[model samples]
Target: MIIGVPKEIKDNEARVGVTPAGVRALTEAGHKVLVETHAGELSGFTDDDYQNAGAEIVGDRGYVWGKSETVVKVKEPIEPEYAYFREGLVLFTYLHLAPIPDLTNKLLEAKVTGIAYETVRDRQGTLPLLTPMSEVAGRMSVQVGAAYLEKEHGGRGILLGGVPGVPPAHVTIIGGGIVGTNAAKIALGFGAKVTLVDLNLNRLRELDDLYQGRLYTLASNSYNLANATREADLVIGAVLIPGATAPKLVTRTMVSQMKKGSVIVDVAIDQGGCVETAKPTSHSNPSYVVDGVVHYCVTNMPGAVPHTSTLALTNSTFPYLMRIANLGAREALKKDPGLAEGLNTYQGKVTYRGVAESQQREWTPAADLIS
Candidate 1:
């Protein structure tokens, strides 16, 4: 199989889909890898590194896309790259299609096989592919929020960990999943008062015990969420629902109620955000003020730290990529039900139920279509 690793064209997306080590693995398995020139430069890998790994360096992005049977990418195809879409070209990437109907339409119209990393599940029903990046984003949320809290950055001029005789900032995380858990860990490490709200009481209980009661875990409810946001100095929206849009737990009224100059980092922005005021921004323009509350909703938060992001993401994704390259996408999906869950679109049909329901489109099960 011929695989393509195109340089990411998404705004400020420096992470490459495949690393030099990944290319070496594929080449050793007798699969050809076509890497666009300097595709891995931002991620700390050089063209010589890829060449040493037996990858062919191609300067033309179109040639890489045109020649490969499967295209592995970090982000979804942007508008410009949409022109390259064709029948039977397998696109394996983080396709956040719930919020981007245009991309979904293009994939279906072009009959592209769209496999989303976020939707892929493991044997334990966990999102394996999405976990590493989620970890990076989760940890970075607090770090970014802390930076945005400084007075110059349009924040409340409060330090995350206050000095002696000064009060520490209050951080409210809106979910208890991977992102929220990691956020809470960092917030607590900063000596801040952290409150986590979630729908799962059992998970909250687990967190409570995990933190030895230092962290406040609240059952998710409108009243609880409203109170938490109003008191928060740094609000991190960490909610997720697999391939679907995140529920807007924090309403516009909640934003209006927040203390002036408070910062909001919606890590769930990729899934349309859990905060009502949150919208996707880029690293170039990462934050904006809404009702005097700062919102940092960069869709590709992990991209800012390309080296770590690429290594972490590719660690989990390479195994699956190898399987797809060796066995072919259809056969790989057929053999592993977990991988089948990753199939958002295949043969012009919406194969993922969550994306279909989010878009109000009819979907055929992947099993049915692939069978």
Candidate 2:
């Protein structure tokens, strides 16, 4: 099998699909790896490093795309790369298709076998491929929010951890999942008043044990969410429902009612955002003000730390990549049920229920394609 690693072209995206170590592993398994020139430059890996690990360097993305059976990428294909998609091409990447109708239509029209890293689930129902990047985004949400909270950034002009005789800032985080939990930990470390909301009682109980009364946990609802937002200096929208658009937890009305200059870091922006006001922004211009509330909605938040993100993402995705490379997509999906869930689109049909429903298109069963 021949695999192509193209340099990510998403706005402010610097991560690549594979690293030198990953190339070496694929090459050792009798698979050919072709990396586009300068694909690893942003991630601190050189073309020489990839060559040392047994990968051929191609200067043209079109040439690499045409020659390789599978195209491995860090982000979704942007407008320029859409033409590279051809019939029977295997696209392996983070295809958040439910939110983006145009991209989904393009992939289906191209008839590529798209394996989305976001929906690849393990036996325990955990997203192995999405976890590493989510962890990175979750931790960075607080770091970015804190920076934007200064007076000059049009924020609340309060320190996260207040000095003596001053009260700390209030931080409200939605969805007590991986993203929210990490945000809570960081917020607590800063001595900020932290509140985490979730629908699951058991998960909330576990968080209670983990925090040991250091933070507040609430059942998420419209009333609680709105009330929390009014007093919060910083809000982190960390909710997620895999393969579906993010639930609009914060409405336009809610945004209008929040305190002036409050910051909202929507970690769920990739899935269309929990905040209704969110529109994807680039790292270059990461925040926008609407209704007196600041929204941080960078679609590729982890891309800002390409070195760590590329390595971490590849660590989770490389094993699955090898499986498909060794056996081909049909055989590999037929063998592994976990990997089959990753196939959102195959042979010009939509197999993922969430995406098909979102687009009002006909759905294809995964079993029919893999079986």
Mark the regions of model 1 whose C-alpha exceeds 4 Å error after superposition: none
Summarize candidate 2's per-residue lDDT along 303-345 as a digit string, tens digits.
9999999999999999999999999988998998888888899
Estimate, for each residue in 15-94, the C-alpha lDDT of model 1 and write its tens digit: 99999999999999999999999999999999999999999999999999999999999998999999999999999999
Candidate 1 clashes between residue pairs 3 or more apart in a chain or in different chains:
none
> Would you list the clashing residue pairs of candidate 2?
none
Best by lDDT: 1
Alpha carbon lDDT at 231, candidate 1? 98
What's model 2's overall lDDT? 0.92
**lDDT of residue 9 for candidate 1:** 93
